[model samples]
Target: MKKVVLTTSLLAIAAAAQAQSSVTLYGRIDNGIQYENGSPQGHKIAAESGDWGCSWFGMQGSEDIGGGTAVIFQLEGQLNTQNGTSSGALFGRHATVGLTNENYGTFKLGNLGAGELQQDSWALDPQLMQRYAISTLTHGRNWPGIANGFEYTSPKWFGLTLKGQYDLSNNTNWNSGVLPAGQGRSDAIEAIYATGPLEVRVIYDELRSTQGNFNNLYAASRSIMGGGTYTLGPVKLWAGYQHLNAPQASDASVFGTDAVSAANLPGGVSAPTSADHEWGGAAWQVTPAATITGAVYHTNVNHGNGNATMYTLAATYNLSKRTFLYTEAAYLHNSSTSNIDLGNDSWGPNNYNGANNTTSGAGANNPDYGHSMTGVFAGIMTAF
Candidate 1:
């Protein structure tokens, strides 16, 4: 009996030690019903969800290493609640590992969302309606692919924090056939400030891609964005501005050339030309469980020959902590010389193509397009 008691005690201690090396499993499940019109010249209604927050499962853990330092890691992936399929490439959202010290800062590595994403994430609009989530609009712009990278986040100082990230291209060439030397390299930098009821951020990103064609046409794109938010009583006001410039081949070597040519191909015979976008919104909490949000976004594209403007509005409502309903409507008023299009050939409909006049559809060949998109979504979300 003595020996058995001693063995049981040892096992207990081992279990406790293991528990100290904490690991947690967490996830959110969201789904709803949706209706869309003016999409590819059709009207449709279907079961939809993931507007407020994508359904996902994640595992995170931290191990104390003594000396006031710890090792941490997280792995997360998105899911499609309707079809029960993976959202995208495995581990598409986040896969990172790093270390933290009580007095120092934290450093992480892998494919992770940018600091700009955090700025957008804090918006109170999504709490009321998923349609008001800025993430739904920015999509690719928010999480530019960095391949392999590292990020550092400083400990908060007087309610202010600093973060920086660097991504290496592994020296891979994306323009072997398009451009003689190619420019398939990229980099990014960002800064942020937060205090009390105010928050602000600025970010700059550049990407160089080589065209796989004769004349070795190389494309280099750059974007700069700055924004801020202020809170007063039950009202929160937000504003932001972004500038994007992409110059492509004089001819049809790049993918965006079709739209460029269709628009009369301005900007001195280059691709993409230039685009400036400005947006702002306000969120009002009408009650504890319900909020009202409204935002307006405008984009001006200059391709030398012509220009165009696009505007959007979105709102949402939270029925409960784990459930919400939302709606979004957008209008693009193109000038006579402006050629605007829409489709979901890439990430999704949110990308918006000007030349085709097609919007992002739910699935491939879903035929949802043209002029405007009005969608109403109602869904429930549970977190664990």
Candidate 2:
């Protein structure tokens, strides 16, 4: 009887080991060719789609514990296929570990995407193959850094959830008379949400930076976004809205434009400023394999600075579950007489020029007139 009991105990241990949990490796490689136009100088054609999709690979794992508890972890990194270099910082995309319990909630640490952003992932414009694809340049806002941070997500209650994150700057030194080295440098947030056929999300962020003595800048940014998609057989329709506010501007000369300094202060002085932005869009599925999307984005800056309006349209055709072709274009108009131009910095040149070639005296060296951006992309993506 004792020998039989020992054998049974060994078998039970083996079974527990097998049932603990597992890890898996996964990733996607998306590439394509693109042609862009509307430069102040003219138009040019280069590599269409090399680093656009920003191909990447990652690993994820979870371990099951008794009584509905488990530990989970994910380490993802971006890859620049064009030149075969590290995406940026280590685990620039995401690096996180956490725990979850069916009867409780979840807690995570390390670099991770905001749950507020993920809430709308499913309702994004369908015409765009990759919403943030470097080549397309016609989709959502980009916040790439996943620095040191921690997050908590509550268990869903009646199809609703809550989540938040805090990022540490880890800086200790501050310039004399400044807000302090890490005063507003760290990233912090709070968010709330609900889901189902319709979903809503609200996110608040704090950003801070210090200049020289007697000069510092701090801003509180907040976004309220909501959208939903309802499917009717094989077709679905979706729409969303986002509102953003930046209440504090930089006072350092190095951070302000020559134009703003000269016009807003004495002897080209600098002070704090504010800005607000609103964005909305819609998407429609023309067929099971094709989609069309449209969006309008508007920005209003304080101090008679100026405003900008952008309209975008795009279409995508899925050749298969893993392959697709897409095209997108955008037209932006700087309507503010303040000569303030806020152009897209992710793709080409930075800064916006005024209508009459009046330099806003902004960062680097901005021209007088702001131009438009139009692009077309034809490529394929594969995932495994």
Scored by CA lDDT, what does every candidate get? 0.55, 0.50
Question: TM-score: which candidate is best?
Answer: 1
Per-prediction CA RMSD (Å): 5.5, 5.8
Supply the TM-score for candidate 2. 0.74
- Root-mean-square deviation of candidate 1: 5.5
Q: What is the lDDT of residue 158 in candidate 1?
A: 78
Provide the global lDDT of candidate 1 against the true structure: 0.55
Off by over 4 Å in 2: 1-15, 48-53, 113-144, 173-196, 210-243, 251-272, 336-370
Q: Candidate 1 — which residues are off by over 4 angstroms?
A: 1-19, 113-139, 171-184, 210-220, 248-253, 256-270, 304-320, 329-332, 337-354, 357-370
For model 1, what is the error of residue 70's alpha carbon versus the real structure, in angstroms, after optimal superposition? 1.2
The sequence of per-residue lDDT tens digits that candidate 2 reaches over residues 1-384 is: 999999999999988877798888887766666555554443445443332255778888889877888999988777665566666555657788999997689998876642223323333433332432211221123232335567777888887676666665555542211222123334434343445455554544443444322122122233444444555554545554444433444443323444443443322223324445555566677888987777766665544445666566777788898767666665556542422322323211123221233322223222233334455555665666
